[model samples]
Target: MGSPAMADGYINGVPVDCYCTDKQGQRIEVGETICLQVDGRMFMAQCQMSLNVPMWREVSPGCLSSGLTAPLQSVDPSIHTLGVDVEIFATKS
Candidate 1:
């Protein structure tokens, strides 16, 4: 798993739940996994909470395919797609 830096946020003196954001500024809820390509390398990543902070942990050794069957929660009203090699399925909330 890749160790990415994490930063937390606060609102009105209350700590808020952390969410993972991609390059396109789409928010991914915790416990969700997504295929990401960083530094020209593709990997499967999941949003996890560690030590009260949210971070992306690599789950798969490498990306095998583009189709992801995991159900996704809608964070944005507009539909979006990742790279040509990655396909994301999201349901409107």
Candidate 2:
């Protein structure tokens, strides 16, 4: 999930254990098997996945005598991808 904050946070309650030093540096652990069904076809795969939230900023001005405030924000899973070898199962007649 996405949240507005200065530091990092979790996604779907899953913790980020590893860090990468670059434009993008975050890792997520997903289960081995993923299943998808479309129309009457079923697909299964063993996959690796990731979730990312790009960094952002938000500025808010106070009313009256109050000063201005700037807060950091991030988008939830700005990018998500899955890589795996998929298998298609056929039904028997």
Candidate 3:
């Protein structure tokens, strides 16, 4: 697969750690970029796995959820495989 450029956006509330993995025995490389936006806050990270296997993982800090109050926007469906899960949180003010 071709590596996509880094995408920028925002994520609301406190950002929780995220992980991505390929469970279909495919080769995915690290350093590839996946852009994500949650609740308006944008996040950018390099791909962390580069081998054909069954899983890739990404872990982000909680600050990615800063300044979030609403729900996340609809994500584009062409950039990733199905069944991916995201988790987020907010700090008590």
Give a tens-digit lDDT track for model 1, residues 1-93.
223333334544566778889879899998889988999989999988776677889999677675654554343335554422332454457
TM-score of each prediction: 0.51, 0.20, 0.21
Please tell me which predicted candidate would have the highest TM-score against the true structure: 1
Question: What is the per-residue lDDT of model 3 for residues 1-93, given as tens digits with 9 covering 90 to 100?
Answer: 223222111124333233343335343355444444456755554455233322323455332435634432355446652535443234456
Q: What is the Cα-based TM-score of model 1?
A: 0.51
Arrange candidates by lDDT, descending: 1, 3, 2
Indicate the TM-score of model 3.
0.21
Candidate ranking under TM-score, highest first, comes to 1, 3, 2
Candidate number with the higher TM-score (1 or 3): 1
Number of clashes in model 3?
19
Better model by lDDT, 2 or 3?
3
- Model 1: worst 10 consecutive residues (lDDT sum): 1-10
- How do the residues 11-84 of candidate 2 rate in per-residue lDDT, one tens digit apiece? 55676543322214323223333333445544553333334543221122221233434431232333431322
- Estimate candidate 3's RMSD in Å: 20.5
